[model samples]
Target chain A: MSLTHREFWMMVHLGLGVMFLHTFFEGILWLHTGERLRRLRIGTGVMALVAWLTVVSGTWLVYPWYRAKPPAGADLADYPRAYLLANPSISQWHIFGMEWKEHVGWLSPILATAVAWTVLRYGGQLARDRRLRQVLLVLFVAAFTTAGIAGALGAFINKVAPNTFLDG
Target chain B: MAHIEIDPVTPSIIEEINSLTSSSDRPALPNGQAGAAILSAGIGSALLGFFVVLAEASTTAKQLMTLDAGVGPLSGKTTFAVAGWLIAWAVLHSRWRKQTIDFARITMIALILLGLGLLGTFPPFYMLFAQH
Candidate 1:
């Protein structure tokens, strides 16, 4: 069966989330002594590839979503847009959260690339050095946290938007 | 000589790796610090771009051509942000290549600078002050 747009997008999003979780797990495993650094490096490299793919797919997902509008002349019916205009404080907070999610989401590729590159270049040192391991741990946590926050914001947008893939 | 032979398959390879890890003469690696800063720079610049675009969306939206295709200032702003981040990363990477400075410390410094750069782009700070 041919995949619908919603199905395709859903699959992509699921892939993104899974890749992100995979990175998180690999990062945790990197901190352990039992696993060889070489294996973890390869794992992170795969995560980076998946992450960049996710970034591209997410962009495809976002563009149409951002461009969406209500049926012509449906002013106040736009829900959050119209409601948000009347309430500046709530609007600001909502906008801030939305923007934060979008912006941070863009860093997935960068974060994943960094993790992969660092491991590739310094895996030996990182495996041996406590201090370096700590830094890597922090970077991993930050990347995971950003993905989580961005995903939360996307869920919020789906709930508030005029139409969502779930509606059909 | 006593005929003593060791299997060179698993144990020898593992022992070699162990010996390498124990060696103290290894070159200084980035330890994930510079890479982290570069990654964070992407986040910071994207955030800065988002706020900057939002601050100017009212005016910029007018000049931006909205097509049947979703071409808008938001996409432009994102592109601009990502470009800026790539440039910043390039510069940092160059310095990282040349310098012998403590990798983690320098990365922290870079992160702080990028964070400050982000704060500078806030609407209340740059936009408001400029308009006045």
Candidate 2:
């Protein structure tokens, strides 16, 4: 069965959350391990790569679905209208559905690739090196925490916001 | 016959040296590495806090502007609060600073609490209590 927009978004959230949670655990494990920095680097590197993929895929999955629906009734029409009024260019682009692609689609893959590369190339050493590991651990914790918060907010919105035609 | 028994001076010299080296003169606790670790953790926690704020703001903005981006501001606030606390605690523990055994035990308990807090944001509980 085809998934509803809400289901799709929830799935995307779940995917991204799992990816982030995986990365968090990997960082913690790296910190705990007494092994060489190289080992930790590889471990974290692999986890980052997987997480990036998840994020990219989730982004792709969510955008078309998000754009297909109109804003929920609770969403202030003034915001989008004001944004359009302020940036005619955005309004023009939105006419053809190009705006969504321009704003979110174009950047998703590039960001995912960049994150993946950073983690793979420099992250291993960071994971193994004590000082670096500390930094990465902090970052991991921060990213994971932020994502979790964002997901909760999204869920709340889904629950409370009136599903206008845009929500379809 | 003029060879007098010369007592060795080595023992006396050693005793003199030992006497000069007092225990109080020894260096204090090794705080250098521990201090560095704490500093690192502090910086990390701060960065995490900043990111959490950024993420929450972005979500709020998106929800406000984007059509059908239904996430509410309250959930954003709640999620950030919970996540921020956990992240702060994690950074503090990771700093590996000197703490009493009781504090260490409490930190473990705090970690569990953090996990539960995060979990509580999920379905069922969130839907049950959070619904207006």
Candidate 3:
């Protein structure tokens, strides 16, 4: 069965979210075990791949789709554009948050690859080194937090933005 | 490559290290290899975007931009990004093979490259932030 653009994007988002959770759990496992998990490196690699997909879909596909088919008339009557547009402060914050999200979203995949590379190059030594482990932990947390925030901002955008995704 | 024979520093540490080093399929890449991938991908994509923005395109060209060439600055931006990353990987991979590279130093070098690539993404860096 063919899926609509909105459905496809939602599936992509869900996949991205799941991958982030998996990476976080893998990180915790490594930390708790105090042992290097080879498979964790593989997990990070997969997470990076998923992140790349999210970036491409969000940046190239979804943005253009939204730009081309902004919702209108009765389609947006129930949408909460006023809560964002009517207030200058809220609008500014939303725009600022989105801008940051765009850039940071790009950074996530890079960070993921770095984590994987570090794990592969360092082997079990990374787990033994307190500082390196801390660094890896921090990067993982940053990637996870960024993905969550981006997802949240995206939901907000769908509610307020002039987009065809909601229009029947 | 100077291999460090690290004694299992702690009992809690797994015996996996010895096996890891012995594994042929999962080769131990150099310390800075991962950073190189990050730098290459970031810089490559940005450079592609910059060039596309600089180019003059007709309405047809813009409309023709689809998934095959969509999302990034140009068609195959991801492909270019991956290529750049792999090239860096190969270069760094070979460099570390010839000499002893420390982990901390590898990290610092990677950070420097990443910082440069990040800076490169902002057009202002090329223009010195002057209003063009």
Candidate 4:
């Protein structure tokens, strides 16, 4: 299968996303178990960085291509947004799925950064502060949920209208 | 990452740790730092949702928010939200840095804001405000 630049970055974004989620889950487990505090701090920091990169790249690089306007009277095949919208049967993918994915997906990085900061600030000490740990856990889970929603919708949209360049 | 071995904390261990915390060279820092970050995150997320709804509802707003032609209004929405979050965090941190803040209340408020942000960004919910 020929892979375009857009497709390549999309895959990188996906891989990083999966990696972030895994790291995020491990953080939750560490907090839940109340062990490995230092590890959680460092892991969370890296995860937060990955989360930020994913969101920024998704928004700046991938999204622009996905939403690129096709020239007048041109085939919409290269324009994922236009392609999705050109047909009523699948327009919902862009309006509903893409809309939600683009906006809500942003929450993950913001919240993850907060979580990372908290962990780094109060590493092993979190084990003593149940309330702090609980609060972080809740926010952490919320971040995960947002990323999961965005990722799922992104996968569906990509399946229906894969965002890729015509030339490999 | 280098591993720093820590004994697994049980309930009894937590109590013991708490007791030793003050005597130890490093005392537990104020919860204010965490609170500021958490609360500001909520603020950012909620504002982002609000921006989504606003941009959808108003053409002028959409145009104003379209910081980059390539990325559309999204660039503005995220930029504004992130700026707001950082500002809020800085302000909150300065005030609460030295003192212990009420985390329970902060958490509740943050959660509510987060929920609003989530609801606001939901396609169905925000689309209701769409002009076209």
Candidate 5:
């Protein structure tokens, strides 16, 4: 079945949210580690920035639709827009769903993979380090891996389910 | 006796002076001075983000553009602000100072929140942006 514009845009928004959570957590883990690997830190920072932007833009796009009210000349055809504006709670649900998708979706696996890579490459040093450092490193690696997987999955979904809000 | 009256410098005193002189002569490493550079970069990025957003929100150029196609300056500015914060934290913690628990936690939480916001754009909700 063909998807409606609202459904498509919602999906994209949700996808972006998932992406943001993945990258955000990874960034935190990167920051937590005391060892400053310049390249790694830079990568994390850039990823975080991208993720942040994606979410903000996505939210901005959906906000008006969520808050849409029936224009004087509008009718049932504009229900999607009207529903969004008349009911603030719908927007909240959308926001919550987006959050859940970001935090709980594929973020865990992606982060895990990235963390594993980092550990394998720097495992020897990490192993030799203090317990606190080791723990943080493990956490970092895990978060990174999970984010990566989630990100990939999100992209796939986007390709298959392109947002079509404007078409409405 | 007069010639011998010249006070002999103590070896211990001379050794102490030599040690002090050596300690004071160490060269500074540029790489080791990463703090200033990192801080500058972080602050600079944040400032740029802030200004861009301001310009976008207030500028006539932004108004003339199609609203649906472009994000305008607000979202871009917010992204930059978040980025600036991340960079600033990295620089401060990595180079200038230690990462305080509160500071680190706050930044991480903020990132997570932003991520959650991003997720709100997914399927079902993706229609919010689709052109009519």
Candidate 6:
């Protein structure tokens, strides 16, 4: 069966989230041994790209449909945001979960892009500077954490109110 | 045993790397450029939080931030954040590119700002500021 536009893009977003985790893992390895700085640089760049893809797609393409307001007396089935909010029991999923996810998720790409540009600009100098390595590591991990939180929330939110199709 | 030629003036590869990383007097690495990037990331994050909280607290701000109807206020919030981040990055990078500044201070400040940004995005925190 062909996927709805929403389903297709959300799936792509999920894939990009996984890709971010993979690159973030590479960054963590730098703490143990600073042997492969070049690889770490590449990882930063990849993380930036993946994060941009994930957030941009989620925000611009998928979010419109997710947050599409249901008309009065209309069925809330297709509107994930409204569906979650309509039910007293599940309202927290939208109020807390989606609220936090959509807002915090944007930070990942910004942080990732900064890290990528720094690594690309400094290049080999990073390998020789321990302070630089440590600072980058902390921010890199923070980037990963933000993306991770967003990713987990997205999964849980979708499970609660799956975007099976585009409503509007 | 084979004799290795040792240069009297130049340090060994390992020694050079160790000193470049750890020595207090070694200030020629142009690390300020890197610090610029790191600090700006924090600024960008904090700016995003600022916008989120602003939108939450002010109805007018929320309406103004709705740059796109479909995407809602998030469209403006993110756009402004990204724009602010780039502007900060450019300003910092230009000033610090040729100089070597203290990395430790920059790192501490950046992390603190990042923590605040993280807290600001929290629904419980930002929602408390929401205008009922």
lDDT tens digits, residues A45-137, model 5?
455444444444444665455334545876523444343334575543334333333333322322332333333333224323354244334
CAPRI category for model 4: acceptable
Clashing pairs in 4: none
Which regions of candidate 2 fall more than 4 Å away from where they truly are? Answer: A1-13, A32-43, A54-59, A67-128, A162-168, B1-132
Output the number of the DockQ-best candidate: 4
Tens-digit lDDT track of model 3 for B1-132: 999786765532454555445553454444454444444444543443443333223334333433253243333433454466667667765665444446565555545644544453333342342223
Ranking according to lDDT, highest score first: 4, 6, 1, 3, 5, 2
Best by TM-score: 4
Q: What are the per-residue Cα lDDT tens digits for candidate 2 across A32-89?
A: 5523334444655555555545444444454344343234564443233233334555
Instruction: Give per-residue CA lDDT, model 5, range B1-132, as digits (tens).
Output: 456553465655565455435533543222212222223323433343333333434555334332443334333444444455446545554653332234344334433533443333233443343333
**Residue A109 lDDT (model 4):** 93
Q: Which candidate has the top score in lDDT?
A: 4
lDDT of 3 at B67: 29
- Residue range A19-108, candidate 1, lDDT tens digits: 676557756776555246656777778777776666556655644444444465755334444444446655653455555554556555
State the number of backbone clashes in model 6. 0
lDDT, residue A54, model 5: 47
Q: How well is each residue in B43-129 modelled by candidate 1, as lDDT tens digits?
A: 554555454545464554424422224434445555655666667667666656544446566557645644544454443443443
Runs off by more than 4 Å, candidate 5: A1-57, A60-70, A75-124, A130-167, B1-77, B93-132
TM-score of chain B of each: 0.46, 0.30, 0.40, 0.80, 0.28, 0.78
What is the Å distance of residue A66 in model 4 from its true position? 0.5
After superposing candidate 3 on the true structure, give the runs of residues whose Cα lies further than 4 Å from its correct spot: A1-3, A28-36, A69-94, A125-135, A162-168, B1-86, B112-132
The count of residue-pair clashes in candidate 2 stands at: 9
- The 10 consecutive residues of candidate 2 chain B with the worst lDDT sum are B28-37
Model 5 TM-score, 2 decimals: 0.34
- Model 4 stretches with alpha carbons more than 4 Å out: A1-3, A162-168, B1-24
Candidate 6, A13-84: lDDT as tens digits: 889999888767767785335555556667778889989999999899888888989899877887888899
Rank the candidate models, highest DockQ first. Answer: 4, 6, 1, 3, 5, 2
lDDT of 2 by residue, B13-84 (tens): 555345334322553222323233323333333332333334334655435433323322322332344354
